[model samples]
Target: MITPAPNVPAIASTPTFTDTEIKPSQTIAANTTTPPTISETLTLPPVSVIATEVPPVKSTPKLANIEWLTKFRGIPGIGVNPVDAWLNETGTTSDPTCRDTRSPSCDKHYRDPLVDNWAAIRLTEVKIVFYKDELEKLITFSGVGSSISNWFHINRVLASSWTTLVGRTYGYFSLEGDAGNGQRFFTASPYQGCTKDRIFTLVITKQVASCAFDRHSSYPQFLFVTGDGWGYPENMTGIALADSFAILIK
Candidate 1:
């Protein structure tokens, strides 16, 4: 009985800032292919008010490039939290060719390195409204301890919270106050999954705010993939999106 061994999954190429071909399930062995790396930078507005006047006219959180869109994955019903009906999570079955809309799911574990996808499509980039905590910043950041300004940007990321029923993983980045200071802030993080084969990339530099990863290798079967996109927590709701779109290149 010459039973052939189970075919090892493909060893897909590393992710690139501009690579359009994507796939599902990949597996690189020890001393195998190198994973891709990514990073991103966000342009934000200033946050300073030193007025002794009383009327207290407020300003909207000015964010550039706002968009709104939707997605459809297999695990969850329909995702309305991020936006409207176009977003979904309908492809969580064992079937490799299930209806995979690509919307972020609150539950259900998805296979990575999928045989059907290579890139994410933009859904929205418009604006929404959220009421931020109006508490006054009592700490007056000055000379010696003046680095207090940078704290705002860093803190926004650290203090975000979300609870997923499917136990998915994620990461996010955005400029803090650099936009106000004529500088841009960038944060990059990789997505995590239950698979030890889990991998992602994050790169932060002068004019780039991008990230990339593969749940499985392009060298592997997309049907067997297992990972999620970088996390976009719910706390970011009503924060206003600039513009968005989705893509299917492979």
Candidate 2:
């Protein structure tokens, strides 16, 4: 037998794996590339509300000459009397008649109705303001505080009953105090709003003798005159539309 060289091939053939030689797959390779980062944006809506209105608060203001004073609305229907025509050249308007001619009551040491009932209680301050052409002129008791002791005004007749000086008649003002305490009276310069060439002024009285006047004897506490087409208790010519007065009780 030739033995064919025992069949030893010139080159040995490499061994190949059969189906039995293979094992099941084990580890899995992870993906390396990161996913492209995604960028996101958000949005929203709006809202609203409501409210009410309120008035302004004002403090007591200081008074000054030609200073901007506040508008004062005094007791309405009160008339401002024209003082110029009533008072004579000597500043004498009232006489012994004491009723018709009672411009400045020529009595001293008069009894105050407020003082008689309440001894310590007296009007501590008084404020007077005149309005014309939408402008204000203010005067206070403190302005003329010095010479006043117990000063007040009185009306002799009803405003409607007074035939003379229909719109210019303001009742009498009594200024009773020690001799020359201070500026006893004030004069309001003439303004061209009234019926006549009337210069307005404040009325104050002086003590001539011991003559004392009691307020209980009078019927009307004050008089009102009609001016600028208004009357007392009903007419507010200067007072309602223009003028005003106020008082501070201490």
lDDT tens per residue, model 1, 1-250:
8999999999999776434543332323533665554433554344443343346778775433333221122222222211111123222233333333333323332333331221232211211111112211111111122121232232222112211112333233222312321111223233233222221111111222121222211111111111223322222211212111121111
Against the reference, the lDDT scores of all candidates come to 0.24, 0.29
- In the order shown, what is each candidate's alpha-carbon RMSD? 41.2, 17.6
Poorest stretch of ten by lDDT in candidate 2: 212-221
Model 2, residue 123: C-alpha shift (Å): 5.1
After superposition, candidate 2 runs with Cα above 4 Å error: 1-74, 78-118, 131-135, 142-198, 201-243
The TM-scores, one per candidate, come to 0.15, 0.21
> Would you give me the overall lDDT of model 2?
0.29
